[model samples]
Target: MNTQFIKASLFAAGLLLVSTSFAQNKNDLKNWPSGYAPLEVGKRIAAHFIATPHTNFGRPTPPKVITYPESCTWYGALKFAGASRDKELLGQLAKRFEPFFGPEAKLIPVPDHVDYSVFGSVPLQLYIQTKEQKYLDLGKGIADKQWGPPEGPRVVAASHEFYKQGLTWQTRLWIDDMFMITALQNQAYLATGEIKYIDRAAKEMVVYLDSLQKPNGLFYHAPTAPFYWGRGNGWMAAGMAELLGSLPKNHPERARIMKGYQMMMASLLKHQAEDGMWRQLVDDAESWKESSSTGMFTYAMITGVKKGWLDAKTYGPAARKAWIALVGYIDGNDEVKDVCEGTNKNTSRQFYLDRKRLTGDLHGQAPILWSAAALLQ
Candidate 1:
């Protein structure tokens, strides 16, 4: 036998062994401990979200237009409902959107910035689950407008410049844009099976990855902000996972995005605290443990392991421990605690450290549902 042939055979055998282990580990997640079951936890969170009226970034006063945080939490609940196969819960979730179509139509946000465009994700998800034409139209419209000309008054000066480069007009270099922009486009692709939607998302992702991802595989809060703010990085982690979960396997951008994703996951695994939580400032040991970032990272890891992108033995336990640790932070009210408050990019490390930790914020609530739905899937 040729030497090269023998080496190839050994490599192939090793891959088979790893694949088998991943399948077994994936099934093992089903045996979760009491109160840690993903379906149960998801339903509880979904119920809480349904009962709670929409608020602006977790504030009691509802915003005039539905914003990204609430939209994200809504999307999470929808995903959980679909994953758990809870028709009643799904119907209830649908009811929540009925108001948006009627008396609250005024609340639909104009698609200008990345945040506003993300609102499309909710309706796109609804259309997928229910095949409602109204949902499809609403979602696809919002997504299309994201790539269209400036409709809202807040267009950045470089908006057209970004658009000319085959990116969204609303493209901003914030790490959060990875999720806010790609997620909506990904959803639009899912809903319509349109290559354009996914292509646009993939293109936008590569740009952000090249511009923002640091040598260490984590991202700064912004170009000017050097700190690895946990939730900010969490957004990137979740975004890459979301896009990869759906992007065509043979697509040109898949390999690059996957590389970026795996690099971030490795860095995240390194930074995970002994408690299985990640700190608000990811690399800062003294920073407080944060729920939102922990949940987002857990979601990403769970996705990677499930999809066989990660080595199951290495990531399987980490994902599970992080999920359990994240649940422990949920208060008696079903609200996740220790969520860093709505953050803006700042160069000051003290600003991130001193930020308020809120309970029941949709920013926190969303990721727990994401992880739950991911595990269930």
Candidate 2:
């Protein structure tokens, strides 16, 4: 045999082996049943999002401003559309934003609070999917203002204090702020390929993890509020997953964030109910099973397993079970039911327990889309 023929055969065999390994990794969830498949679930949720009007946390009235939950849902829909190669759905999702730039310009959130700043993630995802200059300018502008010097007539003292500390002027040390802040900055990094955005996000995450994460890896609603609220911890879980999903492996803060993420995931795994849902207060078995937090945690786990940040054998089954259980909460109207109402950091456990359970809340809708999109990826 010619020496060159032997070399070519070896090269081809190596290429085939690598390609097969990649396929196996990507298709880890390939055994999913037809109705529960990620593609099917993702498309259904995307359609629901496109058809729904702007909501004020599941209330009937139209929102005066675009809320972070809506922004999150929009971002998730865009991701699902892009991943599933649904050009029509992508165009429809894009059209929904046209009003924001035109007649409804007033609805674009002012990035003075973490909740408002998170709206940037939607347009950044839009720009990433479509490469639209207008989207980039709009999204990047919002992300920049979060860390910009305090300005405008509404600036607060906290803004100045946080800014001086090299944190976002909007920082409040709330657990949910982790997701709100990181989502915008991480998306900005993905869209612009700028290290500054990701670095800011990673550094900020370190601060939140150090300050908020407890010995058990869960977080209290706030320093003064000692209750382990489900959605609050869910926000942190999802935030860490989102950040680690993109942060470079060699980045200085990656290991710390990864450690925080792994610790939290293990705790969540222990607290998961027999039905695969987590409660309004994750550590409290007596608290009602909540959809939004459950959805968020499921999304985080799905992302972790898909990214190899989690062990597939352990987290994969948990994530799959959670997704199926979560979807069961979707009502015939395509709205997720049993989502805890909008909550505040309160020391009283009853406050969280008594919060109204809502249907069709974008808070719940967003994470279902995120989990579905992640699984498809």
Candidate 3:
């Protein structure tokens, strides 16, 4: 053989092998996800998130910033760290929430809204685990804010007669508030040994369940909107699961709350794609595979198993399957992919169907972390 041609052929063969190995590493996730630990993958993703911020967040994208949605990811980190009893991870995760509440760590008011109060979950989780007075105080502040008088709906027209008459909180109702605010209330109850917070949380949940939950067992993104945006519904389920995980068994509202949660979980079980993920619209067949909602549903179900609220024989495999699929979305670089961008409730199905799915969006991180924590049990 000619020397030059042989060398060229050898180089070409080497290139082919390199390409083959790269492709295999990529595809191996779908086929061999059981080898990956959800906790490790979750930790890596959370670490990468705080280190490098990525977004097409619509408005100005600040360098290395964290926002409300990403709070969920950190909440999951808190859960994972607390579950593992890893003091280092707990301390690390707890500090990540400081900015949201301001330097003094007081619950910086978000004008007349309850949305920003969701960040309380982080401090509350830290307080619950560490028994640190600072976290407890901050978390209590937020819970009291959420626990206080009705601000009414931020969308003026959204304050329907039903909400005005039925809800107890001073804040306007948003579907996201379910997970955003409720968990903090439960935490406040735990933090202060105050039955009032838990009682208020139960009333708040019923108010939402009455007005927002459609017969389909999923929530409308808002009062006037009938769309079941995946993450919003996921928030409802995850929040309820969070509440149930901590609420006293004989608490007056436990039966009603569990009924709603079970109804929603049954619907979630029905809608889950065979691939172990839920869609962006949740009910819409045309929507994309949404990682955040999938994470939330898995958290809800796995929590049920851990709390003895769900049947392990049934939900355990489902959660593990969901975890496998969820971890697959995290790339070798630790970027979480296919996370739906920030969305508002809209009247049309196309609105949800068209939402952007971005890589490393913080909203995708929490559910995976929480799932890992729950599964570790």
Candidate 4:
């Protein structure tokens, strides 16, 4: 054979080898055991969310930034961290938000421009869990400013309008908003004996559920957005689970909340990938597989089974399968791998899947922590 022909053959073989290696790695990941070490995995991922900082409140600043939408997640991880015999790490995470508070222990920048409800509520929940007055005061300050007078109906800003055109908006209630604000409201009501907070949570939840529910039972992530992002839905599902756990069984809205739960759970089950995970675009498979969303869904489903909201015989197997898929995405050291990094102003299916995954991002770690916590329960 001529020298040129031999060289071409060698190059083709090298390409084939590279492809084969990648295929093998994918298979190895797929074959990983479904059962995960909850305590160990939760700690590792929670550490990542706490360690990465943006501003004084454990929020990342630009050009690398963390949004208020993710605040509940960090707080949730902190809650789990404190509960799981990891006081040292929990204390450290709590301290990160200390700088954001005032001398009276109230959170500064009250009624924040971004998702203020969730941002403030998280610290409050942490305070309640840890008996830290600072978290409580900060949370109360936010609640006072955003929810208005303690005696009247609480009004949430639909968006921050600019120049009368409603430019640079942030006020509209979305499905994910329920997760961000209501849980804290419930905690506040329980702690303070303030009926207003509970009333506020109920009203806003009704608005979100009524306005955002699609004809098919799945709630859209945002009011104006047409596409459904799995993580967004996961946020709503997780919110429902948390709210159900906190709300009294006799509350009038309990049935409505349960109905919403049934709707979302049914829709999510239909969208589960063959490998036991969900894609970034929930109903669309051409999009990339997403671990964060899958983790969130698995977290909600597993928690539901524990709470009797779901029949474990039917959902448990699927949850276990998703958990297995989730572990396959993690690396050998228990860190979350291939998590899609923070997104900005997203509105479409392609926009979500097109996001690049960065290892150890808090967005990924928070859900991973929840996933592990669910398994432990």
lDDT of 3 at 123: 75
Question: For model 1, how does the per-residue alpha-carbon lDDT over 9-127 read when each residue is reduced to its tens digit?
Answer: 99999999999977676436667878999988998899999998878876667798998888999999999988889899889989999998899999998787888889999999999
Can you write out model 3's per-residue Cα lDDT over 96-119, one digit (the tens) per residue?
655655653343435235556776
lDDT of 3 at 286: 79
Candidate 4: tens digits of C-alpha lDDT, residues 279-340:
87788879778887888888888788777888876777677777778877877655666666
- Model 3 vs truth, CA RMSD: 8.5
TM-score of each: 0.92, 0.91, 0.81, 0.76
TM-score of 1: 0.92
**How would the candidate models be sorted by TM-score, starting from the highest?**
1, 2, 3, 4
Top of the candidates by lDDT:
1
Task: Please list the Cα RMSD from the true structure of every candidate, rounded to 1 decimal place.
Answer: 8.6, 8.9, 8.5, 10.5
Point out the worst 10-residue segment of candidate 4 by lDDT: 160-169
| Tens digit per residue, CA lDDT, model 2, 1-377 | 99999999999999999998765544355556557787888888889998888878766788889999999899889888887888999999989998988999999978878888899998899999899999999999999988899887667887788789888888788999999999999999999999999999998999999998999999989998998899999899999999999999899999999999999999999999988899999999889999999999998999988888889988877887788789889888888999888888888988888999988888888898888888888
Question: What overall lDDT, based on C-alpha atoms, would model 4 receive against the true structure?
Answer: 0.67
Checking candidate 4 for backbone clashes, the offending pairs are 54-59, 54-60, 54-61, 55-59, 107-138, 157-171, 158-171, 158-172, 159-171
Pairs that clash in candidate 2: none
- Between candidates 3 and 4, the TM-score winner: 3
